[model samples]
Target: MSDVETPETAEKEELLTEAEKKALIALRRDEAAALRRWWQRLTLTPHELEKLTKQRSLPRGVRAVLRRCDSAEAAMLTQGFRELWAMLPESTKQTDYRDEQLQVWSCIALVAAELRKEESGVSLAKRLGQQKEQTGKPLMSELRFQQLLSCRTPEEFIQRLRRALALADKKGVSVVLLASVIALWWREHRGRLSAKPTQRLGFVLANDYFAATSGYSHRKD
Candidate 1:
């Protein structure tokens, strides 16, 4: 009788083990088709969501740099690159590889290809950096560019890129919001000067706001 299993004990034994349950959870996460929880966890408040969603609010360059792609996967990867772009230590608006714009692009292109276990990090970095000029402005569809970064083996690179992009996008949004606040302050205070009515952003302070938001220096010096 001690060795014989009863109905309750049998039912308990049928339940999934911890490892099996974890595997099932992982499988579901991968099968979701949209990598929602992974990316969407970066939340925003209702007010911020309202602001960021407005079509006219985001600057043209910022919009282009952070625009969502049609393919869910491609959108994630391209955004990964853009975010990575802002974090790299760079001299603002410089025209050389030392600026890191092209270098990160080159890295994106190389890691998108086969992992080639034969490759070493040093060799890979050289190849990636050397051919960045070719990676600039790919004429292919956005999905193709995402496909380039979807290297299956040794997945650490894209993980890092995705993190960098998140940082960049956050900073980009902060800049836009801060500029808008400054613009609002100027619009209210300019009233004391008895200035004539004009375009919303044509005043000197407005121009400075634009320049600051662009991450560009408007000064002649």
Candidate 2:
């Protein structure tokens, strides 16, 4: 039994890593053109650009993909990415690009743009909640959102994420996944203020997209 358990665990871990790698590879292949264009347009340092393209910085779509990323985390990242996409200048849009793929790449660019903004560890989760309220989007209750937002650091962030995942169950709003979403949100949005990086509205909009497709639910705080 012990031997079986060890191998099973290892296999599961391996599968998880593979899933993550596949997601990143897909983003890179599909978004390569946009990534490069954004890199040049944004004047990103090579290192900065690398972080922006990191899988953790992109959106999570589909069930299999979300499982690999932790659903709650993915949700938070989606919110941030969604907000950025909505704020980007019209020049970034390409008529030839597939709509879904274009939105994904736009998130990547938005992350880089956010990182380029003024560096301050703001309450990103809170900001998302606020944006949701302002936009009149159906979000997880404000109380729950605030509870999640109370997480200040990455470690605390993950803990809250786990809770959100548990409450969300497997339906699509897993707490850890939401945490990833928030991290991805932060990854893309934390930066200097001078660049006027697009607002968090894109991430917010993305959340709307997911709510419609994924059956996501939220209540007031």
Q: Which parts of model 1 are misplaced by more than 4 Å?
A: 1-46, 49-90, 105-155, 160-221
**The 10-residue segment with the lowest total lDDT in model 2:** 1-10
| Estimated TM-score for each candidate | 0.17, 0.28
lDDT of model 1, residue 153: 28
Which parts of model 2 have CA positions greater than 4 angstroms off? 1-140, 173-183, 186-221
Top-scoring candidate (lDDT): 2
The global C-alpha lDDT for each of the candidates, from Candidate 1 onward, is 0.28, 0.35
* lDDT tens digits, residue span 1-221, model 1: 01111123333323323432232211121211111111111233335434423211212232233333322234334544344333223342254534332433324322221121121111111122222233332122234324423433223434433332332332222211222222222334334332443323224223433333333222324
In model 1, pairs of residues that clash are: 83-165, 112-148
